[model samples]
Target chain A: MCCESDQPSLTQAGHRRGQIQLLAALSAIVLVWCGLLPALGRTTVLRQRIAFLEARGVNPSAKFFTEQEAGWRNAAEVERQLQEHPQAFWALPWRHR
Target chain B: MSQQSRQVSDDSLAMIAAGLMLAVSLCCTALGSTGGGGAAEAAASAWQNPLSALLKLPKSWESNPFAEVSGWLPGVVGSQLLLGAALVVGMLICRVRTGEFLLPFLKVFLLSVLAYVLAEQKVVKYYGLEYALWALLIGLLISNTVGLSGRLRPAVRTELYMKTGLVLLGAEVLFGKLLALGLPGICVSWVVTPVVLIVTFWFGQRVLKIESAALNMVISADMSVCGVSAAIATAAACRAKKEELTAAVGISLAFTVLMMVVMPPLIQLMGLGPVVGGAWVGGTIDSTGAVGAAGAMLGAEAEKVAVTIKMIQNMLIGVVAFGVAVYWVTYVERTEGTRPDISEIWRRFPRFILGFLGASVLISLLYENLSDGAGFVKAVVDGGTKTMRSWCFCLAFVSIGLETDLRTLSRFLRGGKPLVLYVCGQALNLLLSLLMSLLMFEVVFPEAADVLRK
Candidate 1:
């Protein structure tokens, strides 16, 4: 009589274990899908804000410095100086007035 | 059949398999060599033969006595070829003495060093792939049949090599770089790591029902956090089973290779600026070398962001390793009725990591003191350190391959849980990294974005 009573409980425990395994597998799948896929279609609004700050003279953290930034600064400074005085460089070295 | 007869059959079969694999490895090497036809042929013709290269040595009389000794000593020796030979010799000795074939760790290190040198010299364009593939081939042959039949020792050796390599790698991490991304980078790494780890682990256990907790943890960490290096570090700390390590590595390598090839194109297609793209790639990709490559391909800005982000993430490895070790000891081992003493913890702990920390501290101190002189010193140190780390890792990988049999790995797949866990965790890493990069880099650091655009 006792053995007969325990059979259902034993089967239920086994079922619960199987369910836990299934849930773990599903969570893993969900996590991967979330990580790899892009969150939205286009650049987030935050990216645009960053671009705006970058256009100004302010520097980002030193770690984030890209070679392109150096190039841009160099070119922009040259163009600005040229615009400031459309005349003569032969007689004197160029400097920002 | 009698037990004696079965044992004999197994041994004979193992020998036959080993012989076949060795032949295959040799064939692959020959084919690879021949494939490089023109340049290889030209170089071969112009240079002295391999024998001459072996025979030629720097004149001992030309250098200071100290320098000569330094040059002669195997520990300080710089020659990749010599290192390879030493590794082979070491493995052979171990095999003879123990009656077990262990994967030749030293040989892999040598080959990796060779690859790095070749790449630095522009002799080969893809150093990581070349070395990884080579190590894989050689490692596969040895581990599968010929090497040590016993499991525990090889696993221990591999862990030792990895930890030591990590410690040496510490010197290369500049504290200044860590401060570069400043608080944002730190926050991202700190926040993202636990979330990913917890979620992945939960999935591995509750959902996937992976029987081995160690394997589950490794896969979760590898995919959600840093990849093979992270996996190895964590696995060693936890004293994970050999099968678990193999699975983690397999997953990491597969994803890393795919990401390396696909990421640059994806960035371009999305029209994301270099900075955003690079940060995303760095955060998502498994391998540091692959991250750098992908970043470089994208643009200069991309390279900077990718490398910076990756380095920041890499720095977290030490902390993660420590945590894993603690967890294993305090929670897992303790629950199992094994009260681990502090000494046992120290014994199980990968000591070489201390070396890595020491190297980092030393380098940082030198940099602070030298300032202007730091550049030249950094270059030399960087070159040497990178060479060493690459070699060590390659050796470890080769050892792994040598010990592993494809059949064994396939048998592991019967559970089908690891594959699911890997894919899920990696996917999560990719998305989380992208979200964080977009928000932190794009929104928070607009100046960086503008600079990248220009």
Candidate 2:
């Protein structure tokens, strides 16, 4: 019963097919990633800006982003605001409001 | 292939993975970014972008491709595949009969995607019909209608998926945030949550005399803590049946919907300040998403206070899960005339909890020390973990549905004791949470409340 020859053909076939399916699924995912890596390069740049702003103690809310983009608030001012109201900087919603 | 050896190996793998994550997280903290004292990010209630598909409805499709999709569609899908492969690899490492996991895993994944897509619908998102409930319902529909086939049985790993997710979830339970609002937040969340859970469990056992103590405990934890997540964790800790867990989740989600709708308006009518109002909803509501919604309806201040309070309450699940595991092993499942020793308890105690706590402590400390604060945590740590965790939970819920015979669940509902148990527990929760919130915010720590107001 412990031997490979003892195992039924149907069971062996099923196992083989399942392994192949798993690999195939994984391959498809890899292929998709390969296709989109270039597109993702631009997105990564935006993410880096977000990270830089966050590193400067700026709140990363949409409002903060808009303000920064419009030159209404700079990193220094945002940092000051964070110092005064730490909780306010992190008061974004966990989910959709 | 003895059960004991299998258990040891499985637990060993979990512990190793957990330890590795903690160590890596600590290293990341040492190499932390230079972002000042801005707060670190914790796991949010729902995914910021839940849906990720190439084909979008015409109305959703915008002019720019980047704007239309979330910039990197492949990254999202590839990341998910990586998570799936990781889990499968973990199972295989533990000698979980490799080829058998694929079809069932695929089924669960497909169901979860469907649940996510359904949750993405405008109306569903508004009502907060989360993927947890949808996954369970859809799985239930398939099982009850066509019935789960033999091929699916090999992949139905509800406990495994849940345990993995819980361990990942542990990273998000930042202890530093517990002191964010100071002593008042601690008293309201930590104090009220345990009291309500204890009282509810006692009520179920002594007063209600429910047949399954595990079911009672699961429901109590679910109703008093953070809904589905709590239910899954507690169920695993106490070794509750799949059907019983399902029933508890069903009851929780039903009341969660009602409470989310009713609580905000009631708080408004009572003329509670945003801090008091948010704390009330945060402490009482079972679901984190619903708590956010209820708070949002009140105001921005309320939303902030409520979500923060709920985050505090969320931390209690680890303690509650550990306590339940200890209690069940020592008191509930002890053999007559023989007290289990420390080693016995250690053996019986759920190993995943060690993983869970380890992850929490690691990530919490990492968050505290790290610079770019929430941004780095959100983008790097939580971003990867959240995707994996969501998949694990979705798969777990689906597996639960597949394994559960609706008939068994219906049997539990026959006397409506579970419903009564949930309702009564919720009632106590509401009253106690409200009183605790009022006393802490209004009387004991008015300054903290003022800070919240600011």
What DockQ do the predictions score, one after another? 0.02, 0.03
Model 1 residue B72 lDDT score:
33
Which residue runs of candidate 2 sit more than 4 Å off their true CA positions? A1-97, B1-76
Candidate 2, residue B406: lDDT: 62
**Per model, how many backbone clashes are there?**
28, 2
lDDT, candidate 1, at B311: 67
TM-score of chain A of each: 0.26, 0.32
Stretch of 10 with least lDDT, candidate 1 chain A: A1-10
Overall lDDT per candidate, in order of appearance: 0.52, 0.64
- The TM-score of chain B in candidate 1 is 0.68
RMSD of each: 17.9, 11.3
Query: Where does model 1 exceed 4 Å of error?
Result: A1-97, B1-130, B143-156, B337-348, B373-377, B452-454
Q: Report how far residue B134 has shifted in candidate 1, in Å.
A: 3.2
